[model samples]
Target: MDAILTPAGLLQRSAPATDAPRRRPTREEAEAAVRTLIAWAGDDPTREGLLDTPKRVVKAYGELFRGYDEDPHAVLDRVFEEVSGYDDLVLVRDIPFQSHCEHHMVPFVGKAHVAYYPAEGVVGLSKLARVVDIYARRLQTQETMTAQIVAAIDEALKPRGIAVMIEAEHMCMSMRGVQKAGVSTLTTQFTGVFRDDPTEQVRFMTLVRSK
Candidate 1:
């Protein structure tokens, strides 16, 4: 029998085998690979069970962790000057967030408690959330993520102090990988005044726990 090649097969034959291996996957490549993973995992990728999953997951990721492409200073560029000279404590609590643990690449579900005391001026409420997202998107450990969030706030605002607390359940522990199942971790970072003054630190802790 003579050989016959389909267009895709010909392309595959002519294409350099190592081309893709030499380069990192782009966002689209990652998404497509994820769909491929579904197929490899003993299921039909085209089934209604997964009809929109690939697109939805890709879009959700771009929205959830869009902070990687954002500059922290840019997020903090616009500050609020209408605080009536109220410099005391600025708290934005229960800033809900979700992240992927670097160790297992599984989800970590949690809320962040962020606060800072203005050094020169204060930032918008949403910037705190942006800071949280910035550090959360990357493969991360809870401890590092907590510290990064605090550091970003400290650097951008140069606040008298900054504090971050992350209370989360890591799927690396909860899901199949290790399977602790019901354990949660609390991680925190404090800077400047939040670290210097015991009274101030205690107050911030109290407020975060109150509700």
Candidate 2:
């Protein structure tokens, strides 16, 4: 198990360990698994219309979970220090993303807002969105994903402060269980000055809410 950071900046109980190495399955094996699942659902996977469905699903899964192969640190590696002593909040808002729930493997579509106060240098604006996409492409929970975005920027940029907020609608919640549609979940994480300064947090929220 690995410890997960909470939105309040406290370390809580560890999450299930995901670092264990295992043999990678072949494409044929993956497609076979999909066929087995189809059969379990009482569908004929070999029917003419369904014969290619397994291959299609396996291909889709490869794209859906590609983030697991990406390194977020690499995305933020190039920083430009040519700022003329500009020290203020740099924010990118409403970065749309789609991710799968780690629990049920269903989708949770959302938007992320990221902000940071530069200490000396700053990353490219698009890099912020790239970072969000990298993490969002993985199996995730909203809370863990929020914390990860904040942590990555804080570590890679060493900024004066960092704040991230995510608004999402989870299919696992809406399409199943209680089945409450049109509901959204919001999660936020702040680090450094953003965590200690009340006004900075407010300012970030205000900017995020601005039209």
Candidate 3:
């Protein structure tokens, strides 16, 4: 992909995100909607015990869904070129995250394992985790979130190779229909060398699984 320049004046692989078309609901409207949900759930929203539940849920939603207002590219805009030429695979494993399932709006908690081989430069280790958190804050499927992590890093850093693995337990499956817990869903995404070369992919997984 051709590099695109970002507002940060840095060249990256993807374009900046555009704002959503529709206007966001006001706080009052959001809280009111929560009240409606509470009532639909066979609860009294006006009761003393449940009176402020809507407000609390709305406030929590703001934090949980703040990723829509965040920019993943910005987190990775700054690149560090001075690695003393030590350009091997940089991997960050066990990155814990909690993302809401788009299908049911329930949470899927998981840890992300990320690896990338630098082409231009490396980013701060924390930035990779931050990228995961940003995307995880939004409504997502485990599969889509895994690919998005790879794309965000691949675009911002234009790495020679990139790999992402996510293992999660979705509440939609456990706490609802299936009712069976402890089941995990694993998803992976590979690009460049990691995609073209099978051994590299093996090595990436090996490192992640290793102690």
Q: Against the true structure, whose TM-score is highest?
A: 2
* TM-score for each model: 0.76, 0.92, 0.90
lDDT of 3 by residue, 78-136 (tens): 99988899779999999999999988999999899999999888999999999999999
What tens digits encode model 2's per-residue C-alpha lDDT throughout 124-193? 9999999899888998888888878887787678898999999999999899999988899999988889
Order the candidate numbers by lDDT, best to worst.
2, 3, 1
Residue 51's lDDT in candidate 3:
96
True-structure lDDT of candidate 2: 0.90
Could you give candidate 1's per-residue lDDT for residues 27-82 as a string of tens digits? Answer: 77867977998999988878997977888888887776665677766787776767
Q: Between candidates 2 and 3, which one is better according to TM-score?
A: 2
Off by over 4 Å in 3: 1-20
Stretches of candidate 2 exceeding 4 Å from the true structure? 1-20
Question: lDDT of each prediction vs. the true structure?
Answer: 0.76, 0.90, 0.88
Residue 205 alpha-carbon offset, candidate 1, angstroms: 1.1
Which ten residues in a row are the worst by lDDT in model 2? 4-13
Please state every model's RMSD to the true fold in angstroms. 12.5, 2.8, 5.4
lDDT of 1: 0.76
lDDT score for residue 181 of model 3: 97
